[model samples]
Target: MSAIRSATVSDLEPLSQLLDDYRRFYAQPSDPAAARAFLAQRLGAADSRLLVHAGQAGALSGFVQLYPVLSTVSLAPRWLLNDLYVHPEARGRGIGRALMQAAATLAREHGVPRLTLSTQTHNKAAQALYESLGWQRNDAFHGYTLTLD
Candidate 1:
């Protein structure tokens, strides 16, 4: 298995492609330019951590992005595992698991108290993988979102 490392500006092109594909998976239209711009903004703001796995010939196989957040109840820092994606050709190769593990490791290194993520309820495969990694599903609170746009 290839090692997962922090994504840099040099990875923009491939990383943007991966992001585009990931968005498409969620029913979003293809927009490579927008993907690149969004990722570049995140990189520039330094508000998120992006970890990428390289496949054959140094191509990116997968990526995981984390955003720092605070847990008011605990008065401590936590991380939101915002985005995780593995190329279709790279699926079933453990890349996703590796990316997730790397994210956890990064959070630990930063002294984060916890990491949180959410997925579509129908995404059983991702839920299974996360569960296998010891990530527990929250049963105590209901999640709600409002879109202003």
Candidate 2:
């Protein structure tokens, strides 16, 4: 069967709750309030792209967030895939994969070259899924970040 459609602001609450659980699964702090706030911002942003999977019982199963960006040198539009989460209770239902496929489809429709995301080194499960999806491992460099303050 075909996957569902891209999500809109109306899905913010359900999407946020699912995100909280996804984070918690990775040992992150469980904070639904913070999750809601973050999701709300993405919902309100014009450049944000969300794809969701709704279960047969009408519950949200998964979601992926894509942010619009531009290449610094080439000046071409691109998409930064920020978050991908499948609810624990709804795992093995192909929600995550479907959402990812939907995200890629959207990016392609907009003429974007690729979809990019990251997982921690220890998150082998996620890495497996990404690899299974044919994502390449960028071994040429390491990821780094600096706190803004």
Candidate 3:
């Protein structure tokens, strides 16, 4: 086990692979090149933040990416935990839990009001982890997305 730390351009390759696997988990098509490019763009921009958990052998075990968004009602910055993934081989090693905790810690350190994320309703394991970590379900409002494409 290793500590979770902020990601950098140097971590691009492993990060992209992990991200690609994550997208695949959501039924996205395989596209490693696209994943690499996408992660590069995000890492280049200051718009998003990422934390990675590396294994004892220096392999990437899991990662969490956060995008900052404004909360108009609260008039404060909030973090959207847009992506979180632990490699299948790395599951149950506490990597997912560590990534989530690291993401929340980052938000708190930045003085952000909250950290938000959405996982498929079928993802009971992730939901359990979130609840165990003190993240409450947003029952007050419904979330909707309209794809332009």
Candidate 4:
């Protein structure tokens, strides 16, 4: 299994490529420049935590991006695992699992009470991976999103 570590600014170029691929997987248009800019802003602002797995030749094979969230009811910090992606060629090599484990470790290190993530209902592969890692499906609450654009 490849070692998972925190992403640095030096990883921007390859990380952006991975981010673009991730967006494309979700049916988004390919826009490398936009992906780079978005990741740049996140890294610069220190608003999100990015964990990456390096593949052969030091290329990033997978990544997980977590955003901090405050739970009012719990009065504690939590993480919203907004993005997790493994290169198609790198799948099944345990990179995704490593990334998720690393994310959980990081969250625990920061005293976060919990970590949360959502995947499309049709993404059975991802759902299985997450469940295997002990992530439970939230049956108690429904998630609703308001898109204003």
Candidate with maximal lDDT: 1
Give me the overall lDDT of model 4: 0.94
Of candidate 2, the 10-residue stretch with the lowest lDDT total is 1-10
lDDT of 2 by residue, 28-145 (tens): 9999999888878877776688788877666688888899888876778878888888877777877778877788888899999877788888978778888888889988878999
Any runs in candidate 1 off by more than 4 Å, and if so which?
none
Query: Candidate 2: what lDDT?
Result: 0.81
Residue 132 C-alpha lDDT in model 2: 85
Using all chains and alpha carbons, the TM-scores for the candidates as numbered come to 0.97, 0.88, 0.97, 0.97
* Error at 73, model 1, angstroms: 0.3
Off by over 4 Å in 3: none
Better of 2 and 3 by lDDT: 3
Collision pairs in model 3: none
| lDDT at residue 79 of model 4 (Cα atoms) | 99
On residues 16-129, what C-alpha lDDT tens digit does candidate 3 reach at each position? 999889999999999999999999999888679999998888788899999999999999999999999999988998889989988888888899979989989999999999
How far is 45's C-alpha from truth in model 1 (Å)? 1.1
- Model 1 lDDT per residue over 8-94, tens place: 999999999999999999999999999999999999999999999997678899999999999989999999999999998989989
CA lDDT of each prediction against the hidden true structure: 0.95, 0.81, 0.91, 0.94
Ten contiguous residues minimizing lDDT sum, candidate 3: 1-10
lDDT of 4 by residue, 2-60 (tens): 57888999999999999999999999999999999999999999999999998757889
